[model samples]
Target: SIEIGENEESAMCIGVAILDDLSYPIAAISLSAPEQRQSDELIESAGIALMAAGRKISEQMATG
Candidate 1:
């Protein structure tokens, strides 16, 4: 999500669910950046990266 002025702070946040073996959400991973430092393209890229990282964490958790 993108926040123009949430809590009086300009920031961008993105997250992805980390799922268990049964495909239940066990946790989440997120990234936040100052709005001024992030462009639309950067946010999109970050979202993709977060999703990949979340999947990796979920996989590790399931296997262990």
Candidate 2:
């Protein structure tokens, strides 16, 4: 998901959910930046990276 100008500081954010082995939502990971430094392309890139990281974490949790 993406959020822009929706909070008190009006920051921009990208996020993804972390799922457990059963595919249940267990947590989330996000990145936030000031509006001036955030763009659609940046958000898209960050979202992809965050999703990858979330998957890694989920895998680790499932193993341990």
Each model's lDDT comes to: 0.81, 0.84
Cα RMSD of all models vs. native, in order, equals: 1.8, 1.3
lDDT tens per residue, model 1, 1-64: 3445564477667868899999999898878778888887888888888888989999999999
Query: Residue-wise lDDT of candidate 2 within 1-64, one digit each (tens)?
Result: 8888786376887778888899898899888889888767877888888989999999998889
Model 2: worst 10 consecutive residues (lDDT sum): 5-14
Q: Which ten residues in a row have the lowest lDDT in candidate 1?
A: 1-10
Measured against the true structure, the TM-scores of the candidates, in listed sequence, are 0.82, 0.84
